[model samples]
Target: MLDLRDHFFVPDAPAVELRAFTHGLMPKTVPAMMERFVEDWRERGVDAWNEVPNHWRPGSGEVVGWWTLPETLGDAFIAPLLGAPAGTCIMQPNVHWTVQCLLSAPEPFTAGRNEIVFSEGAFPSVQHSVYQWAAMQGLRPRPLPLGADGFVHVDAVLDAISDRTAWVFLSHVGFTTGEKLPDAALHAVAEKAHRHDALFCIDGYHATGSVAVDVEALGADVYVGGLLKEACGSTGNSYLYVRDGLTLTPRLSGWFADADPFGFQKQPQPHPDVRRRFLAGTTAIASLYHAVEGLRLLLDAGLENVRTDSLAKTALAIEQAEAAGLTLQSPREAERRGAMVILAVKDAAALCEWLKTQGVFTDSRQNRVLRLAPFVWNTTADIERTFAVLEDGLKTNAHQHVVAPASAGPVT
Candidate 1:
């Protein structure tokens, strides 16, 4: 009985977008909020920044008492949904920038144990960013294997850590395969990483708004996420959540990190605390305004509701894909998979292109797996239509993509 498709900026109906796992569809309210943002820039000008009853910038990422205003409202609402406490989550321009800040912070990594460990299945953007950082720092990049399971178990991942390990960072869900790093795995890894003196960080882009997150429950030291993919926000808006006590002096300093940012004193000392230390130069505030409504919409819908729907959609998708004689690369069990379903088929790129022609939007990765993700806006009808086309396409057998072998793993 629950449906939210009317609230979103849906594509012309029958145009099924099973692609929220890749990027989000916008909410209808965002345009109005963004228009107000532009109007503020035009009328109040630079006063807009100060106009928002400013929330105190504690050195750590936690927020304090309630405040009303546009700029801080997003974080106030968004932090809890993403598993971070208020004031503790600082919005950055994007995930790459946040990761850059994390790598630049020199506190966590020790002299001999400065290596970064993540699985090969990590989103390439994150893996490459860390790779570049490790190269520049002369630190080793320890990329472990995903193996035949198409997922790395928690104990195996923890076993990979050594005294020389500085950071253990990976996605909450495997981007290509849609395998989730569940709470048990997350907690176990966090505890072990702490015992080994390594900071446990999560690249939560795939998990944040799409699923339930409790940062404290997960015990992550640092967590980074973006609104672009799952929160129906414009690009250039993301966040980094730092735990309360750990001090990581960010070498990626800019005007925002200054003790007296607006004072023009040009202080050399970045905030010694985790909060402001990582905030670099001025951000595109308009992008953040657009993101707020999406978070608000999700919160209104209830995270647990979304989680329940996500599982239902995923289970249905897997069932449908199987019924279509498609081999699923994702786990059949709802508990093991994320919000998306990945199916192994040859000529995936061509198949995705063909599907686009039919108004069914999807994404392909690893040159074999086709990703179809259903979100709050999607209905059982949308999914039925999408697969019906797939069935129709296969029957035509014209320019069809053959199904690939089950043994094929993700190329990433």
Candidate 2:
């Protein structure tokens, strides 16, 4: 309904992409950005590190170089998305890297506090990193079970926080259920963690562009997310936001994060900028070129508008699913829903494959949960067409007749 399809390059034209929860449509300006990257590399070579044409902020007279693009883009693009202040956010490689960096930091495990509290429904990046740290450090993993409704039980999560809790980890948007945790719930958790002098971190990978976020109001000490999915930027583009005045020294930090690189000191010294301390190695320059292209469209349209569009589209999807007699696996309430909608259908993997044959792209998990997110590029007509095909496929049981691929590769 927003009619922003003109801003994106819809793959294969007529096909309806209902998988923005996994990967977003490429922005129309990516090729030009790529060409600019090629030109800058060709023209400047090694000198590009010190100075290059500021394509990211052209004509604004802002001087940007490859060495500072992480901080520069963080200030121009990511800070506004998170509603965070400047100098507090920086780009990272991915959520996994951010989590690992936090885990490696000595700040969270001070004063004999060794426990990390998180939900069992968390993404592997958070869940796995907590467990990995437990094996190496004097840390304990306290994973709370999901509620009977298959969503986070906020009370249980809050109750789990204690003096032993060093870090409280949670997802702003649950990947498994497409459940968006309410701000009140997140604030309560953050307050509880701070009362006990613990750090609170949120993985907002799926909620970055689709939802309106204010890190200050949420009381998050650290927020990590990526531009790969709903933000429509491609891989190797992730971000981290450290609350102002928070200090963390990571053991896994590489020389790029050193306070002085050319000094070549025998010992490593932490950077004065706390956000820059999260950097590990040489920055991947190519991904930064196209990182904010998609964000430019979303920011230009307004993030609140994007959230409103996502809600309207997802509501239509839920309505269509109910009319088609499919069981909704995701939250039905608009306030608790994220960009994705999940339906519990039999042979979901096969159903996803069949939908692909019908030019409707969706994904499935564990052969039961079929997930789709009707995004900015999708229309109400696209939702109607998808359910039309889904209803027919279910009634005829046609998906069962299809065989799985011999080597289907990765689901995402």
Candidate closest to the true structure, highest lDDT:
2
Candidate 2 residues 142-224, lDDT tens each? 99999999999999998999998999999999999899999999999999999999999999998989998999999999999
What's the lDDT of the predicted structure labeled candidate 2? 0.91
Query: CA lDDT of 299 in candidate 2?
Result: 89
The whole-model lDDT of each prediction reads: 0.76, 0.91
Candidate 1, 264-307: lDDT as tens digits: 78456776545667666675666666765677677778888888
Question: What is the lDDT for 246 in model 1?
Answer: 74
Q: List candidate 2 segments past 4 Å from native.
A: 406-408
| C-alpha RMSD of candidate 2 | 1.1
- Which residue runs does candidate 1 get wrong by more than 4 Å? 52-74, 400-412
Per-candidate TM equals 0.90, 0.98
